[model samples]
Target: MKKFIPLSILLATLGATNAQADFQGTPTTNAPSWVTSWDVTVPCPVYVSENQADNIFFEGGFDYQDARKTVDGALGYRHLMSDNKVMLGANVLYSHEFPRNHQRISYGAEIRTSVFEINSNYYHRLTDWKLTGVDQNEEKARGGYDVELALAVPYVPSAHFRVKHFCWNGIASNIPTNPIDDLKGNTFSVSGSVYDGLSVEVGYIDYTSGNADYSKAGGERFLKVSYNFDIFGTHVNKATKPRFSNTPYEFERMDDRRFEKIRFEQKVISANKTDRDA
Candidate 1:
C-alpha cells in the first residue's frame, strides 16, 4: 500500500491545474520557467489504430528546484496525427513546496510536428503562506501565461531554438482587472538533448514587472540541465519524442525556461508599498 498512497496523492492532483516551484516575491534569475508549470488529465479509455492512437497517462515526479524543493504531479492525454509525424496534447499540473508551503497549478496545450511545435500555459497560484509562520499570504501574481514556439533543426533531431513570451495577467484579487501589456517578458533559448533522459538549455531572458519599468528593459543569461526517468525514450531522443519518455509517469516536468511570472510579484508589492507610504 506504500505505493498506493503516493499514487492516490498523485491522482488527486489530476483534478488540479498546472504547477510551479516556490517564491517569496523574488525571482531566481537563473532558474528556467518550468519552475512555474504543471498539468492534470482525467483518465479515459485508450484506443490504438494504424493511423491514430490516443492514451490517458498518469505521471508523478520530484524536483529539487533552485527556488524551493517541491513535489508535483499530473495526468495528460496525447493523440498522434499525420502518420505519427505530428501530435497534439493537453495537461494540468499541481505542485506543493515543502519549505514555504506554497502551492501552484497550471494548464496548457501543444501541437508538435516533425519540424516544429507550439505550446502555451495558463498558471494560477494556489497557496502563498507558511503553515508554520505568520500568514503572510500577500501573493498577487496569481494568474499569468506563457506561449512558446520551438523549431527543430533536423540535422541534430534534438537541437532547437525556442521563442517564448510571458505576460503577467495583472494581480489576482477580489477586485477584477486586466493585464497591463507593459508587464510582460520574453526568452530566447537554444536547447539540445543527449542520450538517457538528459537535456540542456542556454538562453537570454528579458522582462518588465510592476516595480520595474519596461523602458528600463533588462536581460539575463539562463542555463539548466534536466534529467528524467523514462520507461521509454531512454535510448532515443526525448527532445524529439518527449511523450514516449514523459507520459505514463506521475509528474509534469518543470521546464527550465518557464518562470518569468516571478517578476510580476514585484509589480504587485511595489504598488502596495506606495499605498502604505502615502
Candidate 2:
C-alpha cells in the first residue's frame, strides 16, 4: 500500500496538467502540430496481503508517452507493520524526454495507515535548458520537491471514494530563473474493483500555482481511467492460515487412526511370542 503513493502522485500530476489545458482554453493559431497526448503504464506485479495480514512487497512499472515520445520506469518496496495498521516504503523514478533532450530523476519516502497516506519526493533536473531565454550558453536547469496526501473511504464492497492533495516548490539556479512557483492542488477520485485482479478509476483535479512573472492563479479539470493487473492473484490468497488446537484431547481425537495401527501391531507381536513358547 505504501509503494502506491509515488505512482499515484505522478499520475495525478500528469492528469492535472491535462485539466489545466482544458480550463485555459485551446489555442487556435499557436497550437502545436502535435496536440493530443497519450500515456500507457504497465505494473509488472502488485502483491497485496490477504485478510489484512502483515507482509512485504516489491513492485515496478514502465510508462510511455506519445506527445514527447518518452519512456520512463519506477520501482518501489513496502513493508506492512506487525499490527497490520501501517506501512512504510520508498521509491525511485527516472524519465527521458526526447523532445527536450532532457531527463529527470526522483526518489521519495511514503507512510500509510488504514485510510490515509503521505508521500514526499525530490526531483533533479538533468539538462542544460534555459527557461527565460534561448541562449544555450546561459542555460540552467531547475529542480523541485512535492508532497502528496491521499485518503480512501469504502462506499461498497467493490467501490471506494478517494481524495488527494499535492503541493510543490521549485528552485532555480543562478542563471535562468525558475518560471514556476509554489503549486498546491487537490483531486477527487472514484475507484472500483471490476474483477478479482482488476479495477477502474476516474478523477478530477483543481490547483493553484504562484508564477514568478504574473503571480497569477489558475484551475484545471482532468479525467483519468486506469486498469490494474495483479500477477499474484488477489488479496484473499495472501491471508494467514488458521491454526489448529494443540490440547491433549484434541490431539488424541486427531490421531485416532495412528493409535489403532499401533494397537494392532502390538497384538501381532504378542501372538508371535505365544507361538514361539508353544
Candidate 3:
C-alpha cells in the first residue's frame, strides 16, 4: 500500500522552507509564472491595496482553449507597511480544469512595493489520475514552488515587466511514460493597465526536465485582459472636491452661523446673572 502524507504536515513543511526570509509580496496571488505575463495578471484575480489597511478582495475568471478549459477564483488579504510603500499579504486559491477534470489548491505569501513585487507559492494537487498505458494510479499528492519578480517601467506608470523561475519534483502523473521526474522552468512577460480598472498582458514560458536521455524544452505563450474594482461598492473619487457633499463655501457658512448663535446665547446668560446680583 502507498503511504499518504497528511496535508497539514505538507503545508508546514512548505512554510518552513522560507521562514527566515524577509517578507516579500508576490506579483499576483497563487499564480504560476508560466501561466501569467505580469506580476499582477488577470483571470487569477485578487487585488490587494498598498495604501489601504486590512484590504480583502475576491476575484474569479474563465479561460478557454480548443480542448481545455479552466475556471479559478481567489480570496486574499493585505496589510500596508508602516511607510505605505510596501504591502504584505497572503492568498488562498482554487482552480479546476475541464476535460481532464483536475483541480489545484495553492497557498502563498507576497510582498509588493511601488517599484517591484516578489511572490512565492506552494501548489498542491487535490486529485490524482492515471494516464493511458500506466499500469497503476499515480500519486495523488504532487506539488511545487515558484518565485517570481516584477519590475516597473520608469517611463510608463502603468507598465510592468516580470520574470519567474520554478521547480516541480514529482512523478509525472498526467503524461504516460514521461521520463521526467523533476522539471524546472522560467517565464517572462509584460503587463500594462489600459484604463482605470482594465489591464492587458502577454507572456512566454520555457522549461526543461531532468531526464538526460529524453530532455525536452518547449515554449508557451499567453495573452489576457483583466479588470479590478471594489466589490463592496466603495468607489474612489478622483475629483478634488467631495463628489456627493455640499460645497466647501456652504459648509463654512453653516459653521459660521452656528458659532454666531452660540455667542448670542452666552451674552444673554451673562446679563441675567448681573441683574440678579444687582
Candidate 4:
C-alpha cells in the first residue's frame, strides 16, 4: 500500500501564495513644497454674507503623480458652540513621499476657536523649514502664524464636484488692531470656476492709518496656475496574466494516467538498481 496526499492540502497551499498577490491602489496625497494648501470652509447656521452681495470667492490647490507627486490629505472635525455662532474645531493634515534617494513625510495640526458673529480669520502654518542658500545648502527651522479679522463673513463655503465660487469682503487687520499702522486694510476678492485642483483669486485692497501705508496698483489681481503629475517617483508596473497556461480538465485526467505509469517504472528501476548494487 502507498500513502496518498489530500486535495484539500494542495488547495490550502495555493491559496496562501495567491493571497500575496493582492493589489494595493496608487497613492494620491503628496504635493510639492512650493504649493500652499488649505482645507477651509464655512458650515451652515452662519451663511456667508457675500452670497447676498452677488460676488464670488475661492482658493484651492492639488497635485497628484504616479506616486511621485506625494500625498497630503486630511481629516477634520468641527463642533458648534452657541448654535453655530461660535465654532471650536481641530484639523489634521499630512503628506508623504517615498521616492529614489528621498523619503519625506510632514504633518500638521490646528485647534481654533472662532465667533462667526464677528468676522474673523485665524490660520497658522506650523512647520520648521531649513532654508538652504545656493552656495551652501542652508536650512532654517521656523513656524509661521497668521491672524486677521474681517468686517464681513469670516468663513467662505465651497464644495468639490460643484461649480466653484467664493468671495471675501472684509476690513483685514493684523494681530494688534490698535494704532492700526500699515497693518489695516480693506480687501475684496472674487473668483469662480470648477475644481480640477487649481484656483485663482483677484481683489482690490487699500490701507491708510497712523504709521500705516499700503497700496494695490489699481486693484491687485494676479494670475496663478499650477499642475503636477506622477512620473518621476516610482516604478509601478505589473502583469495581469499568469506565467504558465493552466492544465485543461481533460488533460488533468491524462496526467494522472501518465503519472501512474511513471511511478511503476520508477519503482521497478529502483528495485533493479538496488539488486545490482547488492
Encode model 4's per-residue lDDT on 1-278: one tens digit a residue.
32323334533432332111000111113322121222222111222233221111111213333233333433333343333333333333333322311222222222222111112222222222222223433221111222222221112221111111111112223334422122233433332222422233233323221121222211221222232221222110111011122221111111101100000000000000111111
For the record, the alpha-carbon RMSD of candidate 2 to the native fold, in angstroms, is 24.7
For every model shown, what is its TM-score relative to the native structure? 0.61, 0.52, 0.57, 0.27
Q: Sort the predicted structures by lDDT, highest score first.
A: 1, 3, 2, 4
Best by lDDT: 1
Candidate 1 local lDDT, residue 227: 53
Stretches of candidate 4 exceeding 4 Å from the true structure: 1-71, 81-88, 95-133, 148-199, 203-278
Could you tell me the TM-score of candidate 2?
0.52
What lDDT tens digits, residue by residue, belong to model 1 across residues 1-278?
11112323533433242222122233334444343322211222233344335644544555554444556665566676555555677777776655555667778787765457688877776654233333432333345778899876434445567889886554433323422232466767776655435666656555544323432424444455555544432222333333222222222222211110111111111111111112
Which model is ahead, 1 or 2, in terms of lDDT? 1
Superposition TM-score, candidate 4 onto the true structure: 0.27
Per-residue C-alpha lDDT of model 3 across residues 21-100, encoded as one tens digit per residue: 00011122333323332222232223434434556665455554423466666676666654555567677777676655
Report lDDT per candidate. Answer: 0.46, 0.40, 0.45, 0.22
lDDT of 2 by residue, 1-278 (tens): 11133446744554544323221112223332222333434434344346433233333333233333455566655555645456566767665655444566667677655355566777666665423223322222334555666554332323345565554444333335433344455656565444433445555555555442212323443333333333444332112111222221111111101100000000000000111111
Candidate 1 deviant stretches above 4 angstroms:
1-52, 128-141, 172-182, 213-217, 232-278
